[model samples]
Target: MLIKMNNIHKSFGTNSVLKGVNIEIQDGEVHALMGENGAGKSTLMNILTGLHKRNDGTILIDGKETYFKDPKEAEKYGITFIHQELNIWPEMTVLENLFIGKEITSSFGILNTRKMKALAREQFDKLSVNIPLDQEAGRCSVGQQQMIEIAKALMTDAKVIIMDEPTAALTEREIQKLFLVIDSLKKQGVSIVYISHRMEEIFEICDRITVMRDGITVDTKNIPETNFDDVVKKMVGRALTDRFPARNPNPRETVLKVRNLTQKGVFHDVNFSVKSGEIVGVSGLMGAGRTEIMRTLFGMDSIDSGDIFINGEKRTIKNPHEAIKLGIGFITEDRKDEGLILDFSLRQNIALPSLKSFSPKGYMNRKDEQDFVDMLIKRLTIKTQSSETNAKDLSGGNQQKVVIAKWIGISPKVLILDEPTRGVDVGAKREIYQLMNELTDRGVAIIMVSSELPEILGMSDRILVVHEGTISGELPKNEATQEKIMTLATGGQ
Candidate 1:
């Protein structure tokens, strides 16, 4: 299968998303779509998959012009889009989620349970996924959920598969398995549109790359012809000298400390401390209780037994409200649900935590709120038409920035960041790292839980590797290596 999108244009009211974009995808090859968040890469793919209609463009499929009426119609024509956002029905079973719309039935219209299981098993086997078919989808870890989505796409036997940030939640092992599957699919003549901000993954697996910036295609080159620096320059329209900013750690007294924190069956005996003006990076495989620990600290989950201390004084955090009042801020991993309310405006989301401060004398101070929002928008370099724009209107990277800004409004003494740059681009990532440096410079202690090793090694003052439910090893910045981190993460001494 081959696809060509020429002069694509898309607009939502007055906001233009994609303008005169072009791309060509060849058969049996993995084509990378590289861009900063909101650069219209996903928009262009949405147009091809019929989720969004191109206001002006031409789509040619195998030398014939084709426009699918909807995603279902496009799936019928062998095009499948595995979106960045996992669309799992949390309450549904894994088997049910796999065959939701395309359930197999007998001649009498009775559901064929046995046949569906057989088909689902086959797809899961191909992807090496071990999730239970009868288990609730929400019960699975984020990495497991990601695999389910991949298996769902594979079940379609799609001629063209569009993967948008597919490996964002996957572990190193799962990512290697996925890469092997991509190689197999290429051999089987399946073309993949690989959309990701991870430069290393793109260079390793893709055959060609298309760079998009500001709603237009900047350039397309074969993987061998383009370097990482070149692709990044095209995507951001600027040169990024460093992926992470340099930090001068000035450690002070401990701001937050946890001793023998037990979440029972989830995590146990987790002991750690974050000094003022330090970044403690937590490294672990997905589902290794990293997020669980952070949630407990933020009062999202109750610990079986633990001692949480703030500045040498013991504190009890029963809920998020209490945690906030204690000067602790949490930036959750799932930004869409926990971080920001999509329908809320940028100002509303940014002002949510600081509303009490703005409401002096029991009255809403509109001027103070507006000024605060404007400062964050400029400080974080958030790209938007205006502060009144809905949170959902911004790109993934900008939404993350809004989440950080929301936490920053409170001037926290300790901030817990879980996957701070999970889906962010290189340029935005640098900005975030710089911001972390700035925050720490202000004597804020930061505990960052991350899956990416390079980020941990580059940005952290110290690294703590989580294995199973315990902290297995801790390494200082000058002594840490990827090999050491991976070994510790897998329960090695």
Candidate 2:
């Protein structure tokens, strides 16, 4: 075995995130860790990478017991991790970013720039990544940045690598290239721990699979013997009767409309509308400008040209505050960075967006805020001991609830969710879907942008496929399918 984790137990304050989890990986094998959003897969990986201290566990590398005090220590033991969020300096060139910590030094302690660039180019070529070594890392596309992160890990010459949702933002072509790299790594005898929610990738690259649920190991099986449905059933615990709820037969009058929306290079000449109590989904490949449309609609990005209409009345939105004032709410894709204030308590995070609503004569009403937060927590079934808990400490699913609660508190007429369940687990995803249903039933118009095809098809009343910068095609709920969406999204007209 390349790595063995025995009876691991970890907790944060009163919340036990992991409970006696055991897993083992062999050399030259791609071991996939499957779970719903807050199922402790990340926690286990964090422990292995020395990002978090385990309460109790014995980790063995190559038959010897090991304990990592920090990520550097883990790297010394031939272990490296590539997180979902690429950690690279935008200002630095690829070469500089790759050799950040281990810079080559000359005789007098000066940096050896030439040698580092040469080494970086060699590593990039070896991994089949075509990114320019001298270019700034941040200037590269999201897919290229992801590849740079992997190349940096390779520079460490680690024996075992852990990748967390590495393909989340990648295009189909980029994913294929990544698979080729993984294949090469396997042939080189590198043990890979692949963590992803995309079931297709698991069956494509993984040799063995381990499912985690609420911090415990659920099951482990060979990929050839198991299938996506079986794996999802194991991860979610219950067989999903229907992936998406039935769409309402009648959508009410148009509640929101965007005419000739243009944000310059971001997105151009975008047009759409949402009826009251209707769920409209925007589907496209990453960087196809789906997110830009959402941002522009929510007033986060400046629209060079376009007009927004609420209840058939044209209105100008100067910023997010104005958008909110006009009864529009937006939930960002990156919850950690844009959605929540990590240091704030759950109650504070929920109330931050709508603070004015709970204020009388410019004085904040603590009791009213507490009562509202309490109600939302209970209604959302948020798994937290107290609202006093820091937002950063909560799991991904709970953090998402907090974001939802913030917007739902305002009682907006139109809600826009950008990848709302990006990292959430199966159970949490079901809850979110149910929440959407409840919201729409109450006459709230929902505009969602999602990368998951099933989510776009299942929950949407209408689907708009965007390619390049414009809508390639639009389909009603019954006519929408994976093939149709892909066809339109890939410029199939």
Candidate 3:
């Protein structure tokens, strides 16, 4: 075995995160670490990378006991971590970001810029990455930034690499490129600890799978020994009966109508209507302008030419605040950058959208705010110490739940959700689906933007396929299929 962790234990105050987790990895295998969000997968990897200290455990590398006191020491031991959020400085050049702390220095104490650029180019060439090394890191696309993150890991001569939700921000093509790099690394006897929530990726790329639930090791199996159903069982500690709830077959009257919505150089000639008690899913390939459409509809982006009709009456929403006032809410795609306020507590985050209602006569009502937030916290099943717990302290799924709760407090008639379950676990996905069921049951129209075809097929009453900034086709739930959606999304016309 190349790495072995036994009886790994960790705790955060009264919360026991990882209890007796164990794992053994061979030298050249893509081992998947699977679990529900808040199930301690990140904590286990954090311990391995020296981000967190295990209260009690043993880690063996090459049959010898070892320890990493910090991330630098972990890197020195040929173990590199590629965080889901790339740690590279956005303002720095690609070459500078790659060689960050380990910049080569000449004998005269001058920085060896030429040597560093040469080394960085050699590594990018190995990965088949095509981007200018002199370009600023922030200017690169999300896919390119991920590639640079991997290249940065390669610079350390990494024998073992930990990838956390690597495909979360990548397009379909970029994801394929990443898998090819993983294959190359495996052929070179490099072990990878792949942490992700995507089911298809787990089955296609992993050789072995380890499941965790509520901070304990559930089961580990070879790819051939278990299937998706069994793995999901281990992940959530229960069988997942269905992917989506039974939605209303006949929707009510149209609640939102867009006519000739145009955002120059982005999307144009868009026309659609979302009906009450229905889920209208927007499906498309990456950069097909699905998110852009939603942003424009929510007034985040100014539309060049369009008319929005709410309840058969036209309204010009100059900003999101106006849209919210007019009974429209949008859950943005990028949670980290645009969603909840991370530094604030759950009470503050949930009360954000409905602050005016919770207060009256220009006076803030503390009790009403806390009570309202507490009610949503319980209703949403958000796991937290209390309503006062900081939003950042929660897991990915819970943080997303916070965003939903905030919007729900507003009671919007039309709700736009962009990639609602992007980085969440299977169990959390089910919870969100149920929440959607409740919302639709209450006559709220939902516009869901998703890249996952299965989700669109499973949850949508009607599917809108967008291709290159235009609506290519629309299909009813019974007629929509993976093949048809893909054809339209790829501009089949």
- Candidate number that wins on TM-score, 1 or 3: 1
TM-score of 3: 0.91
TM-score of structure candidate 1: 0.98
Report the Cα lDDT for candidate 3: 0.87
lDDT by residue for model 2 over 1-493, one digit each (tens)? Answer: 3789999999987789999999999999999998876788888998988899999989998899887889898888788999875688989988888988899999999999888888888887765678778899866756578778988998888889999988765656567777888898899999899998777788999999999987999988889999867887888887877655666635799999999998887788888899989899988876788877887878888888989999999998888999999999999877766799999999999988789988868998999999999999998878788999899877776788899999999999999998877666666777889889999999999999887777887799899989988888899888888898999988886
Q: Report the number of the highest-lDDT candidate.
A: 1
Q: Candidate 3 residues 146-204, lDDT tens each? A: 78898899788789999988877665656787899899899999999999889999999
lDDT of 2: 0.85
Candidate 2 Cα outliers beyond 4 Å, as residue runs: 85-96, 104-148, 227-233
Q: Tell me each candidate's TM-score.
A: 0.98, 0.90, 0.91
lDDT of each structure?
0.92, 0.85, 0.87
Worst 10 residues of 1 by lDDT: 238-247
- Candidate 1 pairs with clashing backbones: none
Candidate 1 lDDT over 1-493, as tens digits, reads 9899999999988999998999999999999998999898888988998899999989999999999989999999999999887889999999999999999999999999999999999888877788889999988877788899999999997999999989988878778889999999999999999999889999999999999999999999999999988998899888889777788999899999999999889999999999999999999888789999999888999999989999999999999999999999999988887899999999999999999999989999999999999999999989899999999988878899999999999999999999898788999889899999999999999999987888889999999999999999999999999999999988898
Using lDDT as the yardstick, the better of models 2 and 3 is: 3
The local lDDT score (0 to 100) that residue 204 gets in candidate 1 is: 96
